[model samples]
Target: MAKEVSCPNCGKPVEWSEQSQWRPFCSERCRLIDLGEWLNESHRIADPTDAPSEDPPPSDDLSTPH
Candidate 1:
């Protein structure tokens, strides 16, 4: 069985899995808003592991040089 969660953007309820096309965010627009939040660092999840993250983590190289 799939789980249900509230929409991170609008607080609306959403099923984790559904065939209605809109998923995770309830619609493509919501999905894009979530992505924008992620890009803007409005959302962040702390690592649950006790051990420290690996040294010299790989860079995503998404930044542009000034």
Candidate 2:
């Protein structure tokens, strides 16, 4: 059995381990298009939730200090 997922390029359905030469992509053209979209900032996902916690940086507090 093959797992299914959406094609990142055109939002089409595709299957994992599918009979495709492009594998993750539906086709070679779609793969290239996806790459171009990434380069152009046309596509983006959630922020790095995997980011590590860090100390707060120096900044002026805008509170009324009540």
Can you write out model 1's per-residue Cα lDDT over 10-57, one digit (the tens) per residue?
778788875636666777888888888787563345434545667774
For model 2, residues 1-66, the per-residue Cα lDDT tens digits are: 778777778777777874866757888889998788786563335345545668686565664343
Residue pairs with backbone atoms closer than 3 Å in model 1 (clashes): none
- State each model's CA lDDT, in order: 0.69, 0.72
- Candidate 1 regions exceeding 4 Å error are 20-22, 42-66
Leading candidate by lDDT: 2
User: Whole-model lDDT, candidate 1?
Assistant: 0.69
The C-alpha TM-scores of every prediction are 0.44, 0.48
How many clashes show up in model 2?
A: 0
The positional error of residue 43 in candidate 2, measured at the CA in angstroms, is 14
